[model samples]
Structures are given as C-alpha cells and as structure tokens.
Target chain A: MVVATNSFPGSNGTTFSPNDILDLEKGDPLVFGAYWKKMSEVCTVVIKGWELMSYLSDAKNVCWFMLSEFGDAVRRLHHLVGNAVIQERYIVVGTGATQLSQAAIYALSSHSEAPQPINVVAAAPYYSEYPSEINVLRSKLYQWAGDAALYKKNEPYIEVVTSPNNPDGVIRQPVVKSEADGKLVYDLAYYWPHYTPITHQADHDIMIFTFSKCTGHAGSRIGWAIVKDIEVAKKMTWYVHMSSIGVSKESQTRAAKIIGVICDGYQNIGSIESELFFEYSKRILRERWEKLRKVIEQTKVLTAAKYPTFYCNFTNESSESYPGFLWLKCDESIEDCTSYLMEKLKIRARAGQRFGVGPKYARLSTIGTEDEFNELLERLSNAD
Target chain B: MVVATNSFPGSNGTTFSPNDILDLEKGDPLVFGAYWKKMSEVCTVVIKGWELMSYLSDAKNVCWFMLSEFGDAVRRLHHLVGNAVIQERYIVVGTGATQLSQAAIYALSSHSEAPQPINVVAAAPYYSEYPSEINVLRSKLYQWAGDAALYKKNEPYIEVVTSPNNPDGVIRQPVVKSEADGKLVYDLAYYWPHYTPITHQADHDIMIFTFSKCTGHAGSRIGWAIVKDIEVAKKMTWYVHMSSIGVSKESQTRAAKIIGVICDGYQNIGSIESELFFEYSKRILRERWEKLRKVIEQTKVLTAAKYPTFYCNFTNESSESYPGFLWLKCDESIEDCTSYLMEKLKIRARAGQRFGVGPKYARLSTIGTEDEFNELLERLSNAD
Candidate 1:
C-alpha cells in the first residue's frame, strides 16, 4: 500500500499519480450522498420552501417568535442553554460567527468614549488564529488608518478567549473571569449543547457559535453570536449588513432545517448516522490518546505541557492533556518542526510556533479513524 | 390564502411579526412529499452508531470531499477548478463569493503604503449595500482606534460598480470601463457564463462573484474570487482563516460536485427535463422584462437610466443608451422615493440616495418572473 505523505509537495514524485478518479461507492459519506438521501426522506411536509420568512411576515402576534427557520434554529440554540434568550430585543444573527466576533470588537473599541485603545487578550496556549482574526480587524484599521494593538498584561482593555481552543483544545472556563470582569470581549466558539457545557456565569458578553463544529456540517458555513445586550446585537447587525450582505440565506435555511432534525429527537437518518460517526471518532481518538500517552511516557524524549491540559504548550510545564491533540515538545533546538517531520519522519503535524507556542513543540491531530490513527502512529514509531 | 405583507403587525401593533415566510423560503428547500416521499430514498447509508466526528475520522480519506456523495460531487468540483490556472498562477475558492469580496478589500486596503487612508469608491446608483460594505471596513478601523474618515471622497475612494446591477438589472458591460480605471472595485455578483461577459475589458484591481445568481442554488452559498496579485491573495487567506475556517468543507465539496455534474452533462436525469428548469426561468424573465418595459413607457411616470448599445452607457449627450434599471427621478421635493413608494403604492424599491443618487428616485429590480413583473406593474397602476 502506498503511504500518503502529509505535505503539500511542489511536485508529484509518487509513481501512483495520486488523485486519480476511482469508482465511488454509493454509501460513501465523503460522497455527500447522505444529505441527498436525507433530503428525499424529509421531503414530505419538511420540504416546505421559505416558510420562515412567510411566517415572520404573516405573524399578527408577538414578533419575537416569528423568525425564519434558520432564525428559529438560532433561537432554539440559544434556548438550549436556558440561560440565554433571543428576540429582536435581545439577539441578532450575523453572516458567520466571525462577523459577530469582529463586530463586537469594533463596537467596544470604537465607542466614542473609550479611554484607551481596545486591547484584545486570549489565554496563552489558545487558538493561534486569534491573532489573525485581530489581523483582519487590524487590516480594516490599516485601510481606515486606525491604530490597533494586541493585548498586553498591565494594559487596560478588552479580552477575548476561545474555549476548547483550537490548536491546543484547552477548555478555559472561570479562569477567564478576570478578563470577563474587565469587560473584555469573550468568544466561546465551542461552549454549546453538544460540546462541553460550561454554564456561563455572565450573559451580556460576546459568545460565538458555528453549526460547523457543533452540528458536523462544516460546509454550511453558519455561525452566530449570542449577545445578551440588545444594543450590541443591533451594532453587530449593522456591521454584518456592511460586511457580507448577511449570511447565505440558503445556508441559514439548511442549518435551521438540520437544527429542527436535531431538536425533534434527531429523527432523520442523517443525524442518527452523524451521531454514530462522532462516537466512532471519539472512541478512536481516546484510543489514540492512550497510545500516544504511552509513547510519550516510554520514549521520554520529550514531554508535554501541563497548563491548559492540551496538545499544546504555554507555560513550559511538563505534563499535557489531550483535548484531541498530541502537543509534543521535542528538543528545543529544533527550529522548524514542520520541516523536520516531513524530511525525517515523513510524519505530518503542525509546527507549534505558528500558534504562538515555542518551536520546540508540535501539534498532531488524532482526527482520523482508529485504524488510520494507528497506522500513522505506527509510521511515526517506525521512523523513530 | 393570506396576502403576503412586508411587515407583520403584532397584536398591539407596536412590534413587527414576520409575515413573509413564503417569499423568503428560509428552511429545507427539498419540498418534501412533493419530491422525496420515501424513507429508503432518504436513508441511503446508515452510519451505524457513529457521530459526525467519528464518521469523519473513520471515513476513508478523512477529508469531507471523500465522505458524502454530495461531498463526492464537490470533490470533483475542487479537482476541476484546482487543476485549472487562474490568472496564470493562482487557484482561488471562497466560502462564497461575498467573503472573497470582503477579503480582497481587506488585503488591498490594508497593504497600501500611502500615508493617506485607503478610499473606497463605487459608481453612483450602484448596489444599495455598498455603503454597508464600506461600513464593515470602517468598523474595522474603529476596532483599532483608527479613523475611517480618511478614505471618504466626494467620489468614494474605492468605487464599486456592478454589471447587470441589482434593482435595475442594467447590464453595464462596456460602460463600466469609465469607472474601472485606478480608483474602483467591480462587483460582478450577477456576471455568469450565460449573461453578458463584463470581464473582457475588466481592469485588474478587484472583482467579486457569487454562485446564487448564476447557479440557481442560492441555498448552497458557494462563491469564489480571483485575485491578480499573489501578495493580496496571501493576506486574504489569513483573513479567511479567521473568518469561517475556510468555508464549509462539505459545501465546498457539494459546489464542486454540482459543477462537475454540469460540466459532465448531469447524469441520472434527462436533457429535456433538465432543459425545462433553465428554459422556463429565462422565458419567464424575458416575458416579465418586456411587460415591465411597456408599462414604464406607457406610464411615463418616471424615467429609467438608458440601456446602452453594446453594453455601453453613453454620457456624451447624443448617446442613445438605456440601461436595465428603472432609475426613476420622481420630483426631487419628494425626499425619499423608497418611503413614498411604500406609503403611496405599497411598492418597495431601494432609495436612490443610498446608492449616492439624490433622493426622490428609487431603484427597482426586474428579477421576478414575467407574471410577477406584470402583477407588480398592475399593482403600481392600481395604486397610482
């Protein structure tokens, strides 16, 4: 069997001529046949097109509940938390959660009377792309000739944090309260129904959600924010109208339909099938983590970080937690873990420094099936 | 049957309940029972006790492209486009066309080395929401404590012009060249393979495209952009990553699939049945436009911008061009034509002032089917 390399190579050296079209099996999930199949099943009363808009437009009663299906889904998602609430008075949807995040920062930073520049802070060993998100914000400023900067300790400004953070997958709850108290902009991208339920103590801050991660339908590209404050929601809506013309109406519709399936006991074959997929992934990841833990302990070549309990390192601690990542810190001398892994082990993993972590460590996602994970681990072991 | 109202009045008449669900179509588009009636049709491959993540991990390729049948279709699309050369060097894709537009602006405006703030200028009587797009950019500056006023010009710094523009349906192919010189951004939101090609003389500053207008699959929010400069592309990529995590993998795959089916001649369906949908939409649109044109001429209530011969708008006084938009100027004393249309006739059209056109003029769309178009004209006649 030919092994797939983890690199995007400049030239194809493999004789196998990868990406050759092969006969496809009808049952393949990758085929996205399932959605079509599910569509066929739900086409009965469920197939009503554009009912949400009509419902909203026709409502002669309280306007709070007349949201389109997608809007309803968002409302339902907010309701799932029980602590959260929705309506024109309390909530508004954005093109994506990203729009809301950027808008929230803009609103806080741009308010006429802010005493200082709006400083943005995320817990170290957090999502590496936070900087890039800020970069987009900063780039906007650059166009406008605005001055923005990253968050620094001792600086009085807003802070934003991502829980179950990317790259490291660390769950940062209550620990962020210090920043939250400072009226910092917080991004709880993953604190949702299916993900870890960190019942938020505060309500009126910026919280981000996406159907992609929680619902497993990444292609829909739908994300929203739950702002407890109505004013913030209104401002966010303004930003959205200016930015992307609003989210894809169709995507919102699809997300709303899928949310309906999930809420109604997830009756459709798609959600049921999706549940199975996640279980399998978790089982495989758990197993891989067990093996990975063993390898790290046995090899003793390098250890993991303790704080954040993630696959990434932040404070140079020696123990690590697996939120779904194996953040391994190899010898400190290694400048580029990406090149080393590709050149020596033929193992593909993310270089840590890209994420603000030191270059000594690397991040490997255990996102594959157990078999694939085992095979990859086997390859790594063989290389070692 | 309930008459569709623009806004629903709640019981007390203070709040608005939505009353236009049918018009918006916010839920599942499948139109169940009408299309997919059976469970077997919906239930193709049961993923057997796995969750989405599990299925994702265990899937053969662990790539969404390799997972679903629709995913398969999208994979084909990616391969098709990925294999092609864009501007001779780069291959581009976006969450949808809108994201690319916003991203391109971010890259171009931020990277300019000039001391002057970047200016965003759009042609007069353009998309109603160009100001909002500018707002998003302005908000970015606010986030950074930057002043966005630097970019504003009596003639906007970055000019946004559309061919076959919305509200008017004026196909301004050759005429757009006047604004395409150094200070403009082109919104080719409506440009497609079948429509008038505007890119022939397209200047290389920035351009945007969307699939909803072209593909008839607005629900599947897939759009893309092509940038001539690589540096701009890189910066756009950074912002995109922070936006929606590179769009939806599933949607991308499906988009790819749909494109493949089109290119390969859609299988599992006949050419004639397939031909009906396309033929019907076009026929209906043509019929509507003819009726609309007749009514406008007969009413003589307002004048539309001239439609250009060879898609060129003539500004030379002797030019006999009439564009598609019914750009009406209805007595300048009437400050807002949009409000006047709503109050007097219950007709809804955008205020021309929003597009930098002075008030008392409104922009109307000719996108509806012929029957709808005639109905709109009849309603206007009755209201008048």
Candidate 2:
C-alpha cells in the first residue's frame, strides 16, 4: 500500500509522474496533497444529500450565505494562529482570492459613481494575475492603473498590496502614498507561518486570505476577507450575490470541518495523537527551497531571490522566507528567461513581464508535486 | 426517526417553522429537502481532504475545472431525461446560472470593443434580479436594456430568453428583432420535467442550467452552460477563469454522485427497489401548486398568473406549470402589493417593479419549506 500511518516519502500515488511535463507556472499547492491525504485517515467528512441545501446560512449577518459554523471556524483558526485580527470585523467569503479581490475593488468603488473610474494599482513586480483579474469584464467601476509606485494621480485610488508577494518572497507595504484618499486592500494569501514567519497579526481595512495557500485545498475554491467597515462588507456581499448568487455551501461546510480539525490539532499540541498541519507543510517547502538554492549555486545560470531572516512570533524562532513561488532572474547572458526554461529545459514557468518586470526574470511554483519539484532541481542543476 | 423506507409525511426535522415569520421572498427550495433527506440513506457521499487537491481537473478542456465524472453525469442525465441535446455541445461550468448568464454576456461582448456597450435585453416580468445582475459592476462591456419586447434598435444586442420564466411561468422566446446581429442566451433553469412540461428538446446556441433548480441542491452552487459554438464557450470559460479561478471541484464531485445516483435509479426502473427523482419532486410541487391555487380561490384579493398545459415529452403526460415562484397581482384597491403583504400580512415577497412590472404585482417563492409554504397558503386564505 502507498499509505503510511505516520509519515510517507516519495510515494504519492495520486499526482502526475516526474517524467511528465512539469508545469511550475501556477502555484497549485499540490505538494501538500501528500500531507492532506495522510491527514484524511485521521480526519474525514461525510455529507448527506440533504445537508446544507438552503441558499441562506445566517440571515442576521451581512454575508448571509456564510454558515455560522464556517464563520466560527474561520475566527477560531485566525485566533489560534494570530495571523489576522478577528475582533470587530466582518467576514465575507468568495470563490477564491481572485474573486474577493475583485469584490474588494467593487466594494470600494461601487458606492460612488465618480465621474471617472477609480484607478486600481499594485506595485511593480506585483502578482501577475492582478491585471487580468481586474480587467476581466471591462468593469467601468475600476480600471487597472499599472504600478502603484508610478501612480501619481491626485484622484481616489485603490491599491492592492500582496504581502510575502507572489513571484518574489519579499514582504511588501503599499507604495502609492498620494495626497488623494486611497483605500488599501491587503492580499494576505501567504501570511501563514508555513511559507513565511508571522511577524505580526495583520490589521487592515480589508485583508484577503485563501484556503488553498493555508490548507492546500486549492480545488475547494474558497477564499475569505476580513473587512473593518460594515458598508464595504455589504457592498462586497452584494457584488458577490449579483455575480454568483453566493459562495458554495458545500465548500463552506467542508471548509468548516477542515479548519476545525486544523485548530483542534494545534490545541492538542504536544500529545502523540496530535498531527500538525503547518509543521508538515513548512518542512516540505523548506527542503524544496534549500534544494533549489543549492542547484542555482551549482549552475550559476540564474539568480534566486534573497530575503532577510525574521523572528516568527508563532514558532518563537528566526527563519528565512520560503515563498510559495521561486522568483529567478537570468544571469545577464540570457533574455526571455521563461522562454529559455520552457524551450531548453522543458520546465514551464510564468514570465516576469506579466508582473511588470523584464523578460530576464521568471517565476516558478514551489508547491507542485514532489516529483515535479525534484525534476525541477535536476534540470536546474544541469543548466550550466 | 424521520426516515422512511418507502415514504414519509410531515415529519421533517430540518428547516424553519410555519409560526416563525415566513420568508418567501427568495426561491429557497427547501421543500425538496424532505425528499433528499430520505434519499440520502440510499445515496451518500464521503469526500476525503486530500482527494481532488489540485486546482486543475482536466487541463485539456476549455473548462479545466469541470471533472470528467461531472461532465459525463450531466450528459447521461440529459440523455435519460431527453430534455436537452448534449451532443455537439461544450459544457462550461460556473458557480451557478447567475454567474454563467453573466459569462454569456461577457463571452458575446468580450471580443468586440464597441464605442458604446452592448444593450442586454430581457422581456418584462423577467427574473427580478436581471437588471441588478447585469448592471452589478456598471460594466463597460454591456448595459441592461429593460423590456426586450420594446427594444427597437439596429445596434447589436444580447437578448436573454428564460423559458418557463421566473415570476411568470409562461414559455418564452426571443422577443427582440433587428437588422443588426444579436446573441441569444437561454436561461433554462426550469426546463426540467418536474417544474414544467418539457415539450421538446431545447437546442439553443447557449443554454444555462442549475443544480439547485434541478435537484434542490442550491447550497452546492453548481451550474453548467451548453454552448454550440466552441469560441463562445472558450470566451465564457475565460471569463469564469478570471472571475472565480474555476468552479468548486467539491461541489462538482458531489453533483456527479447525486446525478449519477439519479440516473442509476432511473435505469433500474420497473424494479420494486427503484425510486424515481423527478416523479418524487414533481408530486411534491404539484401538491403545493394545487393547495396554493385553492387558497387563492378562497381569497379574491389577488390574481395569480395563468399558464397553458403542455404534453411533457419526458414524463409522457400533460401537466400545468408548477413554477418555482408564485406571481400574484393584487386587486384594484391595493397599491404596492409587496408593501401591503409585508406590512399587513407579515409575509415577505419581492415586488413586481423589480421584475420590470407594476407595483400591484409581487412574486412569492413557492419552493420554500413546507411549513413556510403552508403558512403562506393559510395567510392568503385569511386575506379579505
């Protein structure tokens, strides 16, 4: 049997083979599938046909579609991890961070029918998907105004700040400090201790998080936001309701179970029966980062992104960042780094140009299956 | 036990009470919960945390998030029911029909950059949420042009045709005609044999359906669109991809199991053990509509929308329309019937003005829990 009681290695029977074409372009987070697959033996969910059949969950709240159990579980997890502030904040759930960010833009811009659409900006080397996601429908409420650092408009703007940023592991802060009123949306998808050290609990006007990055349940398509203002939350809820009616209650119920189990595991820490989720995920990500760095050192063909050490309050230890993605720049001789890797090494990766960077840079995912990661290391080692 | 081997009556443990301020404003669809709760004994779903961990399901398909099992089950159920043509169609999955209708508009308007946004038209007394949904984001791609019957323009437009339409249960066809080209999106949420008589196989350019209307699994938030043109399907897929990343695999998996079970039961028809889904659901809805009509007859204060009986190809019988909502127009004495009902009768319903109709009409949901439906009937019976 491929299954093991405690820990298993190099025997994930479900994922694709290392011999198959490695798609490191997207941060799929399937690397943690082995951990979750093992955890399922101890934690399981059985939903009957009649369970969670209604469209409404809690009618009293602004986000009426959100189940109380799921809401409680979200608060419990945030309280347990000390990642984000839960007190006096409204929780709005979305299909994913992709949708929630759009919801944030809608919420921020929906109220005022300004003469011109509000400019939405993210700093250069921002998440590559921001532009496509914002401009998806040609929304007249907000338009993608590229590069927050360069945005000099004295008009109201919404800036999305992705911490422990995508493509690169650098922790970020909002850069567009204009005289005009600006609303900030923090994309804290990577604010968990597994990928980076929890320096502080995030407290912002609107902060977004995803279950995919936290629990490796990407297929669930569940993401949530913590909003300080009720009106903003309501606007976001209305946007979501008009767009998709509401979030999936099946995903919400299942999410409640998953997050509840996660909190329970940590609360029972130090017991032999307890199995830690972050500990397993962090170890895997840490090892992969080490291997990639060593391969880059040996090959001398690429420059890996560097990060400063941080004291993680949760772990009470200092550690370097292990981003969900590996941002690499070609060593001066190469151009269009994404094309070179895809053509020469057969490893698919996203070009940095998509993130408002030069063609010499590319971003590769660190959270794919183990075989794919191993194959990436092998290819990188032989690059020279 | 609230569990019956063959049949049970009036002992539902779930849902709200008749005495608890009935909310019939939205189509909640909890009446089918009684049937599903019983059917769950025969069909159960157990999903593990690790299974379906990857974001990608089938990378080859336009809708990569759609599981092959779900696609197959959808095709099989449609084939068995003979309500829709599944061949030469590309099935694109969304959060629900709410999202897919938006996707259809986007798909039709995305490639073209007109000086002015295209007018999206739906006939009067359409789904109450149509205008709000189309103008949700004040999208630059399309704008809501109310009353398709009145639209007289040579410019390109997108007309939504909802058959067995919401608010009013009359069968619908495209109302707008023009010299310029126009795209059609069919909202076939009520094209099932249980809700209305499926007169013929619906073969449209783009047809959207929902699991909530079909199987009373509203919480699953799963909807699919069958498109004749591959390019339009691709465009719709792109819109969904940027919006929600993709539909929930958890919902899709459960939908596959639920629909698969329904198909299996039908294939085993004539056996003593076999129990039909549509027959069970149709019977419950038929009884509710009959009871509601009786109550309306007792109280001449309101007039209900009329419909013509049709021969159902799937059920092989003639039946009157059992709409998911009750569209009622108050007598000449009453103005703003929704306000009168909410304030005087203590019943909540959506006003007709929301559906591009007059203040005298209001739409109440007929698919709420039995307790709520019964209370509505009792209250109406008491109305003078």
Candidate 3:
C-alpha cells in the first residue's frame, strides 16, 4: 500500500533529513493556504444544516446519533456495491489505506501458530513503501519478524504481494508454477470502482483500497480491506482492533452514514464532487501513463508492455519493467540514467534496488496531479 | 492516556455490535446536519472567525502544525501545565487518547534486551478498560503475554495505574512503594485545567490525557502523551508510527492549530459550556460518590480508606474503595450489590471481579450528565 516516504527506515535516525519522497516539497497538500481554501467546500458538505440556537432547547434528538446523523448515511454505502455479498465477511474499514496495508501485514504475520516469523513478498519494482511497511512490522512496537530481503528457504510462512502493484501499476497474475501453494498477501491499494480489475482469485489473499484516489478524501484517511477467507478476515479485524485502538470512530461513523445514504440509492451517485474526484484522479493517471508510454516508445530504449499497464522487462543493456513507474535501467558506463536525469531535470524517482529489484533499475511514480505530471514529463523529456 | 472506548479492547462493545465496529463504521469527521449542528461553537475559540463557511477552510488547518500557524497564541498555553511541551522530546500526538494508550502498551511490551514478562500493576478500581488494553497488547497483532486474569514475566511491561480513575472518581496516589528505579505508568486522563490545577507539577511518571474530558472534543479523537524518560518517549513515538499509520495526521494537525485559541489565557475557562461539562461530570460523580459514601457511612458496611483520590481500598468488609466508584462487597447473605442494582434498577455497573479485584466487591460508575446522575442516585438510594 502507499506508505509515505516520511515513514522511511532511517527517518528516526539522527542524520535523517527530508527529501522529495519524505517531504511533500512544493506540494500544495502541505500549503495550508490552498488546503484551507479547499477545506471550505469539504466543510460545507461536512456540517451543513447546523443551527446554534436549537441546542438551547430541550430536545431528545440532541444526542450525537440522531435521524440525521452522518453515520446513518455511511452505513448505506454497502448497497452501492451491489456485488458485495456478506458485507462483514468481505470488508474491514481502516483509518486510511496506509493503516489497512499495515493491518494486512499484521494479520498475515500473526496467523501463524506459536507466533512464528512470516515473510513479506512483493514483486519487483514494487511500492517504495513496502519495505518500510516491513520495517514497521518488525518494529519493536508491533513485534512481528518482518524480514524484507527475501523468502528464506524451508520456512513455512505467509507472504505479502501486490497486484495492479505500486509504481508500475501492472496487474500481476502469479506464475502458477512458481507459486504452487505459497500464501500471497496481495496489496490492491489502488483498485477501486473504476481502476483495473484484479485477477488473482486465490482464496489466501487480502486486498486493500483507499479513498485518497478512489474518492477525494485524501485528508479523510478512509480505507478498506477485502478478504475472501473468513479466518483471515477475523485475524485482520482483530489486528485492526489491537493496532489502531480502532479506526477513527468519528471518521468511520460518518463514512458509514454517508455511504449508507449513497448505497440506499437515495442520493445521486453522479454528484458533481464525486464525479470530479473520480475524473480528476483517473484523468491525471491516464495522461501520465500515456506520456510515459510515448517516451519509452520514441526512445526505443525500453520495450513498452501496454498502455494502461506499462511494464516492459529490459534486457542485458537494461533490466526491470517500466510500468506505472518508468523503471529505467541506468548503466554504470552511461553515468547512470537515473542520477543523470535527476541532476539535469530536478526530478525525483525511486531507485529499484530499494524494492529488491537490484541496482540497475530506477522507478518514477505518478503521485503528482495533472499539472505536476505535465511538468515532470517536460522536464524529463528535455533532460539529455 | 484517556483511550476512548472506540479502540480495540476499547472498541465500544458496550453498545454497538462487533459488526458495527468493523464494516459499518465511518472514516470521516462529522460535518453536516445534526452531527455538525451547533457543534462548531464548541471550538469557537480554537476555530475563530465564527462564520459557518470558515469550518471548511478551518478543517484544512487541522493538518497543519498549530505552533507554526498560531505560534503567539500557543505560547500562552505554555505557562499552564498541561502536556503542551510540543517537541520531539517531551510531546507526541495521537489520533485520540485511546491511540496513545494502545501505543504506550506496545512500546512497553515490545522493546527491551532482557524484556521481562509483563505485568500491569494497576491500582484497584481503575478504568475498567485497563484489562482490555492488556487484552489488545496480548492479542496476536501486538503479541504480548497477559490476560485480565493472568500475566507473563518475560514481556516488557505496562501498568496502567490511573490517577482520578474511571467508575471511581477518587484521586489516588500510589500507596505501594515505587519501583527501585522509580518507573511508574500514570494515567492522569482527567487531571486537567478543568479538574486539577494546571500549574501543579505533574509527578515524574508516564502520563496520558484526552480532549474528551478537558477540551470537549470527544468525537474528534485527539490526545497526547507525556513521558518523563526520553528513551521511553522515543519508543512510544515508534509505536505510534506503527499504529493507525501515524494518528490520522489530520486530527493531530487540527489539534495543533486549534488548541491555542481554546486554551487562550484559560480566561474563559469559566465559560458556560466548560462549567456545564465540569459541573455535569463532577456533580454526577459527586452524587454517585455521596450516595455510596452515605451508604458506607450509614451501614458501616465498608472500612475503605477515605482519601481525595479516585480510589480507596476497602480494608474491612469490601476489598476496594467506594470513592469514584461504589465498590460494594456483598456476600451470599448480602445481595451481590452490582447484580442486585442492575436487576432491580435496570441499570448496569461493572462487576469488580472484572478488574482483577475479585468477587464480593461490585463497581458502579457515575455516568452521564447531572440529570442522569440524579436518576442514578435515586436508583442506588432506593436499592435497600
């Protein structure tokens, strides 16, 4: 799931300093002026019909949970996804997507009998934060053995993997031969109502999604987990309970209530705000993906896989797939394409070695909005 | 810290069903209609320029650091002695008091070289949920060794030992000798600018606090932790990092922004709402305490040590106190006070045995506002 770079391993180290990944840096999200302006619209939706005078009166409905309570609306959201059978069986709410990712890790790591160690496995060119999630799990606080290097042999364990995975954004189907009976902990943090559909139907996988991209409530911190197995779901629930204390009750109650309203079909799903968020997120990603695809196509550098799923494995001269992220295989003799690109363009991209993919490949993510994406493309294109 | 009932072990199983705690909960703050109606005034000082449109814009400020935005005002609060030391050393923020409590437990139980098995040596008749905190820590996610009824010796430890405990409103100072190293975990959840003097120096012990009691933002779920020892503070910070993906970032940032205005000079500390909440909270506990104290005084049924603290040990007939909570001792001949009170009055009080305080003693809480307190007094007074 998207663990923010601020949570990087050496963040707590004495010499740690903020960088592009860790620090939003020129990111409007951190600029209170812009955020506060947008928050006004959010607040209007948040607290609409409130009247100060009514509270002085003697009314039984003055309690937090009244007929008009936000929680009532959130509970109704289940009906929107008509396919979601047995809501409790398939869903678990989280404070945010990041939380759900960690909870999924905790659940997979904990299901072992006698508190044994568990291995977290992700495909190459994975989410930069996957390793950090491992660090958090192995953190003395959560106390699970989260070794990120590789799956040690002869160990009976649970393994975490991502689908429509981070950076590359490619939907990966497990190689049937290689993954005979190994457990797969899938991270589908980006999969939502309109994104690419996940294909791995293995019963032993847990998938995560977030509202930041799916909905426009990035600041709201709402996310959910989809698990097919009931036992795994139970463990996940327990982990959520133990870990977050509980997801923000205020957030949860409100989300459930709003979702309840939407699901009941009482409110129009095509509301302006909702549609705006969806279109904004999807359009930005679509444009970035297209631009990156064109770059690879024109340069004749790395063979491009597909448009939506841009992953192409490089050869001896270069290796690693270029997906949602442009995984570039920088050569030692060529002054390292990634370092050169960064110095020349002021662009920031993750080094693939961090993702257990080796030192040759460097990854660039599409986290920026449309404007920033355009800027990044122009900067990168002009960089010799 | 005043962990809210919204957390694991703290999840409000007391009311909502488990399913509600999971899939049906919301993950957004209450903004519109009934939930937000008239609620904005509750933070008028903190959220200045009281126009309704301001809330939306203000909600954005919730993510920014308060000191950075409102440095001058916050400096005023520094003189008052709450956990306002906002820095990496002494201050750390949480999603709610519940989050900090859970984090503290994790920090205590998961780190250390020869980590001894943990034992939470809470004083008698403390917050009833201490056991649940223990349960969460011992759960598969956190993986410590302890139950409400039992404890392990090798785990790192967390002893809740609250001051001005729940159910019982008595303020308690440790009766037993301190650790030779003088390490103590103190929960001053309610000792605030409202209940206790803010200027008084807090004992050199680990402490937790919540906005619910003092700041009247129970729904917002913001809290802070104060640790005398720096190393323990760092460990707790790490624990917090691993929990809730870092405390809703939104809530803490909002708290940082708003706290200054609310705590302004503590001048309007005598505001109608503050007085109402304090009197209501205090009068209810005072009424309940007086009834139990009256019963003990009249019947001479218990020989509990009379102290100003939230608790007193029932040295004679009962095994605990009747200060904040009415810990009644009833034998076969005498009615099991808790059950008897519940069965006849349709009211509920915790069974003392739930607190590891053994059977025979029943603990009853002082719940709700003034009127509810009066109703409870009538119920208990008429209970023979």
Interface DockQ per candidate: 0.20, 0.56, 0.19
Clash pairs, model 2 backbone: none
State model 3's lDDT: 0.44
- Residue-level lDDT tens digits of model 1 in B234-341: 766655656654554334444454445444532434232333222233343445456666666665355555454342111112222222235666654566767766
How far residue A155's Cα lies from its native spot in candidate 3, in Å, is: 5.3
* Interface RMSD to the true structure, each candidate: 9.3, 4.6, 10.2
Report the C-alpha lDDT of model 2 over B332-356, residue by residue, as the tens digit: 8899899888766778889989999
**Candidate 2 TM-score to native:** 0.95
- Backbone clash count for every predicted candidate, in the order shown: 88, 0, 61
For this target, which candidate reaches the highest DockQ against the unseen true structure?
Answer: 2
* Ranked candidates (DockQ, high to low): 2, 1, 3
Least well predicted 10-residue stretch by lDDT in candidate 2 chain B? B1-10
What order do candidates take by lDDT, descending?
A: 2, 1, 3
Pick the TM-score winner: 2
Query: Residue A152 in model 1: shift from native, Å?
Result: 6.1
List per-prediction Cα lDDT, in the order shown: 0.46, 0.85, 0.44
What is the lDDT for A140 in model 2?
Answer: 80
